[model samples]
Target: MRSVDADLIRQPASVLAAAISEGEVSSLEVTKAHLARITEVDERVHAFLQVTGEAALAAAELVDEKRRAGAKLGALAGVPIAVKDVLTMRGVPTTCGSKILEGWRPPYDSTVVARLRAADMVILGKTNMDEFAMGSSTEHSAYGPTHNPWDLTRIPGGSGGGSAASLAAFEAPLAIGTDTGGSIRQPAAVTGTVGVKPTYGGVSRYGLVALASSLDQAGPCARSVLDAALLHSVIAGHDPRDSTSINAPVPDVVGAANRGDVRGLRIGLVKELSGAGYQAGVLQRFNEAVELLQGLGAEVVEVSCPNFDYALGAYYLILPAEASSNLARFDGMRYGLRAGDDGSNSVEQVMSLSREAGFGAEVKRRIMLGTYALSSGYYDAYYGQAQKVRTLITRDFNAAFDKADVLISPTAPTTAFKIGEKVDDPLAMYLNDIATIPVNLAGNCAMSLPVGLAPADGLPVGLQIMAPPMADDRLYLVGSALESALTDKWGHLLIEEVPSL
Candidate 1:
């Protein structure tokens, strides 16, 4: 690999795009640099399950040709990105980190992937993820866990760990992550990256393999707020194919990011998310962020969302119930993995055997929990009550929004933990999303950007900013403002501190 290529992988997507457009660099060179970076570091990180070097080069070449012809292009045209395997692409295999869909490649791209192509972004390949976006850490992947780039022994955070890790490892400049609970933000938090969870229905979910149809929203993961905003613009818009998609104009995220001024914003700190069970380092950094925001003329106030206390309980019931239903189609009768095909076995027996062999322990655990919760005797006691809790959570958010223009919190309770530290302890694992879950529960927009490093572990801490649904531009404005202030304070980007892979 060229030494110059080494520098290209480290540059942000926005800079690369400008360089490519201005003829200071070719798109093919940038794509090749990232692909080479992946080849150099991915085995140690296990961030990508697959890498499409040839296809990325071809796409980059097409963008270069267009630029030479003086054709108008999308703002992010010719940038390279890593896609979380949960979103389907026309020719690439999307495993969703489950054995059931081992080699299945969708014939058509998801709305997000289609838009990326329309914008001329090169797809490096699908990154690994937790099985069907199920786990808080990437340990649930059938292919094996994705290691943290900062410390390979620790996790990069989950469901979307591969997406986060790929960015941290400098394998890709931008990535896509789906947030159901805290999948996107938590991973970004632990990995020292930027993750955005757009308002529910803000980004189309038609082609995203659903974990919970009501909660899943796909958004961008990047090394900076502006880079994430650039990506958020490309992938987010109303899609007629998605019933849950919001039929509204996309927010002015790019403009908000560029403006990056929070002079008169009211930033609220969720009372329920603070204190107790949170690490000292995370809290220290969060408090510092609040002070910094205040210095920038943004007012910080404490707001209560009492119903948020019960969000964890409600999300578990809702996600598993939806997951059980969505995964039913992956039985022996369908297109994915098949098992127990002896002629003597009945169809029912074959179906049971196939699922038994295909699913991982965590996936099966959730399926059983969902089945029991939805059973005739327990439906009202469990699932019905969970829905009530979800409503209360949403109402709490509405009240909180009335108090302040945006909400703030530490993205996760702590920084990156060892890979196997909480894998066998499901409750401890579930607690990681406590700070981020309520946003998904309320179907609003939120973002996690690096605030500073924790003194205790010397790992990154993320500051989460939230806004009311459809007011997503607020998230970008606040996030970019805070990001700019933090970068200035530290005299460098947080990603600069990551250890060389």
Candidate 2:
């Protein structure tokens, strides 16, 4: 067997699956190659919190046995996928990159994890993430930061930074990540990978550690839209275990990917996102992407979702308020790490001490803010008002959909920044997701693909494509079309064009 390099890992999962099925390569060989690649590159990138080597190879051996037995296999049989720590996998420690839950393993698997296993996908391991998925940069992770593969000193965007960095570093071809406010898409944008946040409730969240219950969603990260669609199809559908999981039938996203042209497709460009707040280089790349869409026969139009101006504020309020309530379950007695070993202290002292020791600074800050926002005197003023704003944001998206099939924007205001640059200022870091948050609030589907590299810093920029509720197939349709057009124009995938380290 040949060694796997960055270019080889960039091949779509479908191609790898085909090769594995034909006996061109054994599942064990594929798993070992990915593990070697991670060993070579991940130390500098800090992409994974844990690497499940023995278990992954053991699963691969089973896949090989099934192949030899001539049994039917899943579409992604033998493919390796990096799972974000936010999703629970039985017997694997799911830290969610928080010290509070360090070394804690769930008794059961998340719906997405189960689906991946059913598909015969090899679980590479848990990736690093922001503590409780609270920040836009992975610097807040209790385990440490994940660096950008493009430039080791820069960020790879966050919460899903580990997933994005893994793809960029050629550590894995497919990864699963969660998005609350641009966690998946932003990381994909900066790392030059394709990341999709399926329509809210499209994928079940049965064992996912909650960040913001109403807004958090998990989806696929890969090098192409088709791969994302493939992973999305397998994991999306109704799950009886999660009450909020949508009962609607999962669409044939792969079929949508096969629909090549965007001819006569009405693509809306949100005017608000392209304005002053956006970096000049980001806007340039965004405009170029729009031009590519037009050349591909898409009917591009400028649309305004006037309520978007308030989205950032609304999200900050709602996310923290919900996070405070959801994270309250992490008392000293229930799970992983516990502080204050002295038995003389009261129960309340033990709980407080554990939290104070376990949580990082950002987590503490958010908890305090959330507690204040939801407190008696401020509940109506802060949390209640934020809910009203969320309603208005949803209305704005609804009105925009009436005019266009989908909306587009720059996934982030700027390209990947240097690590530690925004770690001190929570507000500044949160602003990075201004454009992507509204979609989550509206329970719509969205995806981000590398549009082009920004000239200012030479880092990749991402173009975000969004669709109305349950219109997830449309995102894949447009995203695949745009990806095909852009890659053809550049003569390579965005990540392929990056300067090799």
Candidate 3:
């Protein structure tokens, strides 16, 4: 076994993979190092819902054995990674941080998880998330919220917060996250990690727990753009099992990430996503990043996505409406927790009671909101109207892309907020995704990379790069370039500045 340091844990997945491939460290050692990290800081970070130590060690041992036998391996082989709870892993507990499915172990692996296994990556564990992937801050999680590693009192962002937190905390080199209304990117933004929401169909949805079917996308979360591209290459491809999976070649994201050149690229700053509503420090860092891009010879321009203002309203309606339909399968009759099953109660009563007891306030709120929007009388007025707005948002992206190679914005209005500060304020909580929701509605590729820390809050601020749908490589190309420039200026990545637990 090779001795490992905090520096080993701090290295990005790409560096870890190279070390393992070069025989400087065995996969088992890497896995043990990460598992040790989970043991060390997870109590404070609460990033994981459960840690699959034995399974991870076994998987790492296999990678080591194969390496010793001189067998060819995937580029990310021997790296340990975390999976957001929304993705099913065979026999692993995947509650989505909701009590409705408490004690449930998935029977089979999701397409993404299967791909990770095939690549010989060690699955460290499942991370915590908002119940049913519903909230902007992870405080909606049934298992209690994952605290920001930067400031323990603050949130780690939502739905995919645990995945982002784990990477920021250095508990895992890479993680998988889902973006339905910015679950991946928003969390990445506040946590100072790199998160990419691949083009809607670029990654398979099969085996991912449905939140809003059309809006849901599984993507990569890592600490660096190149590391994200490495993980992206492993999980992205056509999956016959998923009807929405695009039957096309996965974009050369790894190559694009390596290129890291914005020279002659036209970068657009979205007019609607920046300015007044954004936090002063967040906007300041974002503007500075834009200046950095210009210094790198990228052409900068302002593009208006006028329809973006309505994205949040439309997304709330569409998301809840779809979530209501998707979550209907959790009735007491089949699986998961069942309540009011006493002989006196009817089956319908049992189902109703079970749902009432199982779901949290936030989940129930969305369910009811969705139910109302989808109700016969209101469908056309609410859900139907929201879809029209969705179309407009898509058009906005299309028009913006025509003017610029990529669109940019501050990933969120602000950095991580105190956990309970906005939990009681639903409107405020939802506002956290203001900049990120438009991309989901448009069904395009977008990424959030830490540009710097907000001086006021001393927390991470992310710059979002959105590319035209299916041109996912552009995100990596721009994100890597910005990441390099920022790193050079700061002398270290933003996450490195995190106060020690």
Candidate 4:
């Protein structure tokens, strides 16, 4: 392989797209550089479930052809990206990190994937994730856990860990991930990347495999805030197919990112999202970031969202109920992982056998919990009450937003934990999303960007910024401002500090 332009793998997606468009470097070269990097490190990182080099090269070549012919290209044309396995891409195998759907190839592209293609971004392949998007750590994935690029022994964060890992590992400049109770933000927090969960339905959910229909939303993941904004602009819009999708003009996120000015903006620090359970070092970095934001002419004020305390409990109940219903379609009679196919066995027996052999422990636990919650005489007590808590959380956000333009918190309570540290302890694992779950519950948009390394472990720490629903541009304005200030201080991006894998 050519060593020249090998550095392309480390360039941000924004930079690569410009170079490719200006004819400084062909799309094929940039694509090859990233594919080679994936080949070199993915064995250890295990970020990719599949790598479609042949198809990726073909797409790149087409982009080059379009440019040479003076044809109009999409905004992100020629940039390579990774897709979370939960989104279906035409003919690409989407396993969602479970064995039940092992070899199933989706017949058509999901709305997000279709948008990526429309923008001329090359899809590298599907990424690994927690089985059925059910775990805080990627260890629940049937394929194996995605290791943290910062420290191999540590976790990369869950459900969307592979998407965050790919960016940190230099396997892809941009990737897509879904956030259902912090799947995208928590992973980005621990791995020192940028993740966005746009307001629920800001981006259509037509093709994303459902974890929780009410809470699931797909967004962008990248090494820098600007790149994430660019991807968000490309993929966000209403689709008639998704009844939940918001019908409105896409926000000017890219413009907000470029401005990077937070002067006179009202920044609220969520009182309920701090102290006690939070790691001291994480709090230290978050506080320091607040000071920096204040220094940038933004007013910092304390705001209370007391209902956030009940967000986790409510999220667990709501998500499992939806997941149980969504996963019921994957029985033995359908495609992928059919077991006990004997004439003597009844249809019920075959389904029981297939599900038993195919599901991972974590997936089974959620399914059972969901079934019990929805059972007769228990619906009102569990699922119904959880919905009431959800309403209360939204009301809390509404009251807080009345005082502040945007709210702030630590992205996660702690840095990346060891891979096996919390696998056996579900309750402990769930705590990692304490700060992020509230945004999902309220259907508001949020972004997680690296602030600095935690003093305790030298791992990355993230600052989460939240905006009211459809006010997503507020997140980019603040995130980009804070990001630029931190970079100036450190003289480099937080991801630049990652050690060689």
Off by over 4 Å in 2: 1-8
Q: Model 3, range 1-501, lDDT digits (tens) per residue?
A: 134667788888998999999999898988888899899999999999999999999999999999999999999999999999999999989898889889899899999999999999999999999999999888999999998998999999988999999998889999999999999999999999999999999999999999999999999999999999999999999999999999999999999999999999999999999988899999999999999999999999999999999999999999999999999998978678999998999988998999999999999999999999999999999999999999999999889988999999999998898889988788988999999999999889999999888888788999999999889999999998988998899898888898877
User: Candidate 4: minimum summed lDDT over ten consecutive residues — where?
Assistant: 1-10
Give the lDDT of residue 498 in candidate 2.
60
Candidate 3 least-lDDT 10 residues: 1-10
Q: Give the runs in model 1 whose Cα sits over 4 Å from its true position.
A: none
Model 1 TM-score? 0.99
Tens-digit lDDT string for candidate 2 (1-501)? 244544456577878889889988788888888898888878898999999999999999999999999989988899999999999999999999998988898999999999999999999999999998888889999999999999999998998999999988888989999999899999999899999998999999899899899998999999988888888988899999989999989977889998856899999989888878889999999999899899889899889989899999988889888889988998879797888879798989989999999999988888888898999999999999999999998998988888899899999999889998999998899889999999989899999999998988888999999998888899889998988888788898888876554
Writing each residue's lDDT as its tens digit, candidate 4 over 1-501 gives: 466655898899999999999999999999999899999999999999999899999999999999999989877899999999999988989899999989899898899999999888999999999998888779999999999999999999998999999999999999999999999999999999999999999999998999899999999999999999999999999999999999999889999999888999999999999999999999999999999999999998899988888899998899889999999988968587988988888888999999999999999999999999999899999999999999999999999999999999999999999989999888999999999999998899999999999997999999999999999999999999999999999999999999977
- Show where candidate 3 strays beyond 4 Å: 1-3
Angstrom error at residue 182, model 3: 0.8
lDDT of each: 0.92, 0.90, 0.93, 0.93
CA shift at 214, candidate 3, in angstroms?
0.7
Clashing pairs in 3: none
Which should have the higher lDDT, number 2 or number 3? Answer: 3
| Residue pairs that clash (backbone atoms under 3 angstroms), model 4 | none
Sliding window of 10 residues with minimal summed lDDT for model 2: 1-10
